[model samples]
Target: MRHPRLCAFLAWLYGNEATTGRILQQNQIIFPAIFWPAPENAPLDPDAVLGTFQSAPATSLPEVFELPGQTYLRNLQKISPGLWNGRTYCMKAFDLTEGRPTLTCSSGHFFDALVSCDLLEFELLSAFGEVMPEEEAFPEFCERLTLRGTLHALGNPLHHACGRSAAIGISTLIIFPAEGVYHVLLRSCGSRLAYLDKFFHTVPSLMMQPMLADERMEYSVRHNVYREYLEEVFGAVEGEMPYTPAQYHDIYADPAIQYLQNREAAGSARLLLSGVAMDLLKLRPEICTLLLIDDPDWWLTHRQRLRPVTMVDSRCGSAANLLERSPATPLYAIKLSPELELPTGLLCPERFTPPGAAALCLGLNQVRKLLLYI
Candidate 1:
């Protein structure tokens, strides 16, 4: 992204202090632990409005935390700084002048009111930086907004402000059979919704699911993936969530939840694309995450499938016969790639596809040259 404005902001945000806030790229956010309140009784984050209501109250929460236990980085304290050599991780705590947002989420509903607050120990995760030692940080920036244009009615100023600040949670899964290699599925989110088309760019990669109001546990990448995958693919199961990563895997291993390929990827596959694409593989520890699973099964033949898009040549092209695609269907980006096709047949659609679909598929692939990563 031509982050000229973000660069200007960062340049000013880190005008002083050599080691602290300096970022190679505008997307790389740094939060030194020293900046955090010692007892992490932080100021409320902007997410509190939507996040707090989505989860059970602090009073009802159990002492134990549930995480994807499959991750390699066992405990944050147990691992060393050296382990983050190739990927990003929670590097070290430094100090940063926190931005005390004027608003905080109410933790009750998606459209709930934003409360006036300053301290964010509860939600503002501005204290530590998920540092990637290897790659250059090309950041992604966004502001949460409700795009109700000017003629919209607003009687209460607070309602207008909170509605304007409602957060949009954009979560993606870089499904890969092996490290650095991604499995992009073709998702047919419909030619209808303006929102889905913009975010997925009509043709997109990665599994996209927005956070529901009830998913109140603090945002964890692995858990987000696990929870979204199960609900989106398998439909929700009633029970306590698996507390350990292995338990999470056991559910995945179920024949019913067959999400992975039958076997591990045979060898490293390579691909070449003609657009602006770079693989930013930021390992755990670096991102705002609890490295949930050490390793996850990728070649999922999950039978409970979304209706595959109407492949151009497929005889079953009637409108009534097809299903509107889910965000997970962006796998078409992979089908378009000549180099990275897997050995499996179900994964690739016929090459001679529809021109309209082909155009979107290609356009999204072009954008991905800049956005694909784990």
Candidate 2:
């Protein structure tokens, strides 16, 4: 197998596997175009890029989120006959008076019960249920959810080298029954932080510090550039660094931020449309879309309570462009991007992954996937 770091880097630089493959192929390396494994007892066609979009059936379904007249969850659950498709469920809600959190299951219990049962039964699987007011269940599942799940739902990803199972963390689908809205909520577990730390460090060392580093690097570069301009104009008589408005170039021009600003400035719109043909050729056979989260800190913080999730550099607005390159291309992105239109039935957290919650929060299945990546 190719070096995971190199594979990760190529994914970052090219913004998608199709482009990554093209970049490698253009260099004349006969690399495996497919990363995810195809199912066994199948064709030995190495030319095929395995993925769900191609392998899975496409129902031209009208995208009706919650069925009409399904105002209450009980009704929806009854008629839907396995709304979650049998995935486990848990509930979380806030205690306004106490103000921390109040999580429970439909059984009227808390964490202990959930842990004891090894399964959770909740109201509907929605963030509003986690954050809003609700009646308590008997022996509630728990106020704050902390545990793990099996990787079956995670869409197993096998790292080719070791033939090991990599954990994918957890991902939740947020279905807004009333508003007819649906989204995905992603989270990871505590055990995966060390792996994530290693992932972040693989990128430019400075990327590990978090989003604030981008700001600080900009400030430092701006100051340095201004100083250079001043010295050129006034003959190098340096004492304390002097400042002058005229000495400044656009912050975007600072060499330190050149790569970052250039990538963003290119605009996600252009990237999504630039390589339609290439994207089609490289589609995978299992997962429909793959978004690599570049920031370990962001992934750790924002993914709490959702599942074992990672946040790649959302600044890569190119994801939207990459997705657009192929009609059936899977969409991927970090925390934020203009191009990342998550497939129907995925939820994205609007806030940061809270500190110290990394381990307890990741998805059980995602953990299983990372074991493969590592």
Candidate 3:
């Protein structure tokens, strides 16, 4: 990597308690622990969990910092050529009031401004002095940038004032429940970007994007999650741009998509929103959720067919076909006991991406309550 010092500093920042404390001080969590559950302990309806998406004009990094930030990104991408600059749905504002979370977003790109925020943070800290320890320097960084106080005051971590595109990350934990046990699927990502070679929730943790010209379709988290599941888990090829209405119809008509929808409608499966939080390291917001399939029959019948595409392969055409791709990343099934407590050894907490670990914890908490009444 071009910025070895910055990279090494980040390595030290991961899982750092100082970072966690800073986030908590702003009333933001690094994990999926902020659910607005119903009175009966059931997850709120998916629609109720999210309020609405308000359209806004795109924002960019402050002009003063744009050049240096983009220069840093260019150097970093030299070693990670697989990085793609694609269109994104940038978060302008986020609000949760009365148990309903709403968002304001605008058009953005991967290279437009989101990825540079971390570099800017690092640069600001380095300006203080090279000799200071990061733990001590971080608070000063926040004070000078005022991002933490601004986020706390506005109640929006991705507030436009931060001068970041703030692209949203959508992460879901897929769980398959049998007789009395829950099987959680996990993915070990091999990409060089965020969360490199770390265990993330299977079913693909994706960024929010505008897949088509339809505003409603592009903004729907349900549609985004379902489409990602098909592409990553089943290796379904996404249609190219200038898409026709018929293309979308075919996408939703895929057997896997239909099955998931039917199971949810039949009350045998659920797609619940656990909560949303910012990754302390990058300041990126993640929408954490759970995809719980209560029926074991689905798993027993399709276990062999679950061919997950790796993060690297998904970005580039490294393999001729889905079957030619590398074997699926390690999958672990933590067999839950009658008490629903997760067993050790099968999974390691430190290996998980922060959002993934949080989703698993929150998902299991909700499932424990859900199964009690089932």
Each candidate structure's TM-score, on Cα atoms with residue i matched to residue i, is: 0.30, 0.17, 0.73
Cα misplacement distance, residue 87 of candidate 1 (Å): 33
Off by over 4 Å in 1: 1-108, 112-163, 176-182, 190-219, 234-300, 303-333, 336-374
For model 1 the TM-score comes to 0.30
User: Which of the predicted structures, 1 or 2, would earn the higher TM-score when compared with the native?
Assistant: 1
The C-alpha stretches of model 2 lying farther than 4 A from their native spots are 1-178, 188-191, 195-374
Highest TM-score among the candidates is held by which one? 3
Q: How many backbone clashes can be found in candidate 1?
A: 50
Of the two candidates 1 and 2, the one with more favorable lDDT, higher being better, is 1
Candidate 3 segments exceeding 4 Å error: 1-42, 118-161, 178-180, 191-197, 308-331, 345-350
RMSD in Å for all candidates: 18.6, 24.7, 7.7
Better of 2 and 3 by lDDT: 3
In candidate 2, how many Å is residue 253 off?
62
> Candidate 3: global Cα-lDDT?
0.57
Kindly list the per-residue Cα lDDT of model 1 for residues 10-53, writing each as its tens digit.
33333342333122221242211101111123312212211112
Descending-lDDT candidate ranking: 3, 1, 2
